[model samples]
Target: MAGKFIVIEGLEGAGKTTAINTVARVLNQHQICDLQFTREPGGTPIAEALRNIIKNGLDNEPLTNKAELLMLYAARIQLVENVIKPALKIGKWVIGDRHDLSTQAYQGGGRELDRIFIETLQTQVLGNFKPDLTLYLDISPELGLKRARSRGQLDRIEQQSLAFFERIRQRYLELAERDNTIVTIDAAKSIAEVTAQIETTLNAWLTN
Candidate 1:
């Protein structure tokens, strides 16, 4: 059987890192070992370079919306082709910190880009490829930003207005509602509560 691709998605400060670790443990308990963990726009050297550009705003001028979208896709394509696909081919499960859904939520919704255009890009680049399961940790923008700020100085994307993240949150909900593979998790609760919920959800998914 082909290896499964599981993606964990959310805005900054949604505890995706912790959730990913929990997911690896849960999957191992289910005998799904040989997992490869990856994050976008990274997982490979080229992708990491792109990620720095996306996050740091190191460019002399502000990145255009279209340019930013293309760069994200470029990074994703590199990671998928070079790292994720190769690992999965060898029967290794891939656990991704974020995926294309992020582009839909952040760039399409938060940046106010046209959804249809974004969908077209996805189709062209990914073709029917998608994660077998996605866990979306949902949290309000204000609370999420508060947590993110506590970590350190915010990056370029992380520094977006509260209204931008609110739109991203709305888009994520809308997409999750339409997709059966996407499971929404309430991330406002305590860490223990969130971990328990994630474990339960993963167990149920494995059972099914």
Candidate 2:
């Protein structure tokens, strides 16, 4: 049997990192399956290097929307080829913090980039391997961004304006609406509540 694939998605401060780590531990405790928690932009060596560049903005110039989209795709392709597929083939549960939908949100909505172009790239490059489950942490930009800022020194991508984050949040909701595999959760709740929500969802999935 093919491995189960799970995706955890949300805005900058939707508590994705904490949830992923928590979920990984939960998965292990239940012995549901072998679980791996990883993130986008870099799950491999070369892709990680690319990730640093994208997040840090060492280029120190505004990245065009198209370039931003393509850069994300480039890293995603590397991730799929290098890590995700191989693990899934061996029956490992792969929990991606963010995946292609993120590119669609950040580049497509946040940056007002070309949608058709991105759809074409996704269709052509990432075929058939869809997530078994996608957990959407639904939260507004105002609430999410405030939490994000408190985390630490913001990265270049995180430095984007409130309007940009709003667009991305809207896009995430749009994706959840369109995709049946996604489970949207109320993210404005406390960390423990949000974590509990995620746990409940995963538990339900495992029972099915």
Candidate 3:
């Protein structure tokens, strides 16, 4: 049987790492031991390089929105082809920190890119490939930013204006509303509460 592909997505500081760990532990309890972890814009050497360039500004010229979108897709495809597909083919479940939804929310909403262009690229590059399930942690931009800033200096994408993140959040909600495969969680809750919710969701999914 083909292994499942599960993705966790959220804004920066949404505790995605912690949630991922919790999900792994819960899955382990269910005897789902063969698992592979991956993150978008990374997971492979070349993809990691692209991640660095995308997260940090270049020295001379500002990166254009189109260039940023292309870079993100390039990194994503690299990870998906080299890491995700291979792991799944070997019968190991793949859990990702982020996936295609990030592009829809960030580029389509934050950068104000055309939705048709994004959809077209997704179709051309990915075909019908998609996660079996996506857990989306929803958080207010202010709280999310506050948590992110507490970690350290903000990255290029993290330094965007509040309006930008608001748009991203809106886009995320819109996408979630349209996709039944995506389950939204209120990330503003306490860590324990969030973990409990994740556990419940994962358990239900595993059994179903």
The residue-by-residue lDDT of candidate 3 on 1-208, one tens digit each, is 7889999999988989999999899989989899999998899999999899899967857999999999989998999898899899988999999999999999999999999999999998899999999999999999999999999999999999999999999999999999999999999999999999999999999999
Worst 10 residues of 1 by lDDT: 55-64
RMSD value for candidate 1: 0.8
Q: Write the per-residue lDDT of candidate 2 for residues 98-206, one digit (tens) a residue.
A: 9988888888889887789878989887977678888888999998888988988889888889999999988888888999899998999998898899889888888
Cand. 3 TM to true fold: 0.98
Which residue pairs in model 1 clash with each other? none
Question: What's the CA error at residue 151 for candidate 1, in Å?
Answer: 0.5
Error of 1 at 181 (Å): 0.2
TM-scores of the candidates are 0.98, 0.94, 0.98
**Per-residue C-alpha lDDT of model 1 across residues 43-153, encoded as one tens digit per residue:** 899999989999886747888999999999999999999988888888999999999999999998999999999999999999998999999999999989999999989
Most accurate candidate by lDDT: 1
Q: How many residue pairs clash in each candidate?
A: 0, 0, 0
Question: Better model by lDDT, 2 or 3?
Answer: 3
**Candidate 3 local lDDT, residue 191:** 100
